[model samples]
Target: MENRLLQILVCPVCKGTLRHDREHQELICPADRLAFPVRDGVPVMLPGEARTLEQAPEQ
Candidate 1:
């Protein structure tokens, strides 16, 4: 999973590159301000399954 993620994963919405946030267990799309969840080692890439950054707690 980690191998595939780092090597080739892109945002479904914007087609932009994603950065894995291990602490959050998510793949964040900065341009789209969305976070795709990594569930049981598989990434849930659907937009509807994403969490919006606007609703996220500030770091």
Candidate 2:
């Protein structure tokens, strides 16, 4: 994801900053423990589209 976009993108649920998980191509909202998917270089910021952190398998 572009640094400029990353800087401006915030979790829709918590309005908190997100950490980029490059390997998973996801924007991780630590405050909400949700992972927003990034597909084709676009962030899917919708809350309904996000997956809970607990759902992700350990890497």
Candidate 3:
């Protein structure tokens, strides 16, 4: 994602900053506990299209 685009993109629900997960190709909103996927270089920002995050395993 371009820096400019990423700067302007916010979580639709909380209007919070998004952290780019380059490996998974997603824009994550920790505040919302949701992950928006990037498909073919395009972010699918719709809430209905988002996936809830499962808790990561303890290390």
Candidate 4:
């Protein structure tokens, strides 16, 4: 994701800052424990499309 885009993107649920997980291609909302996927360089910010931190693949 572009640095500018990442700077502006916020968690749809809590409106909190998101942390980009480059290795997993996800934008994570730590407060919500949700991971929004980034597919084809486009962020899928839908709550329904998010995965809970528990469901995140083990590092």
Q: Could you give candidate 4's per-residue lDDT for residues 1-59 as a string of tens digits? A: 89999999999999999999999999999999999999899999999999999984555
Better of 2 and 3 by TM-score: 2
Enumerate residue pairs that collide in model 4: none
lDDT of 3 by residue, 1-59 (tens): 89899999999999999998887788899999988988898999999988888944222
Relative to the true structure, candidate 3 has a C-alpha RMSD (angstroms) of: 3.8
Best candidate, TM-score: 4
User: How do the residues 1-59 of candidate 2 rate in per-residue lDDT, one tens digit apiece?
Assistant: 88999999899998999999999989999999999988899999999989999996345
Q: Estimate each model's TM-score.
A: 0.84, 0.91, 0.87, 0.93
Task: Estimate the overall C-alpha local distance difference test score of candidate 1.
Answer: 0.86
lDDT of 3: 0.88
Q: Write out the backbone clash pairs for model 1.
A: none
Q: Where is model 4 more than 4 Å wrong at Cα?
A: none
- As a whole number from 0 to 100, the lDDT of residue 6 in candidate 1 is 61
Which has the better TM-score: candidate 2, or candidate 4? 4
Best lDDT among the predictions, by candidate number: 4
When superposed on Cα atoms, how far off is each prediction in RMSD? 2.7, 2.0, 3.8, 1.9
TM-score of 2: 0.91
lDDT score of residue 25 within candidate 3: 81
Q: Any runs in candidate 3 off by more than 4 Å, and if so which?
A: 55-59
Q: lDDT of each structure?
A: 0.86, 0.90, 0.88, 0.94
Error of 4 at 30 (Å): 0.3
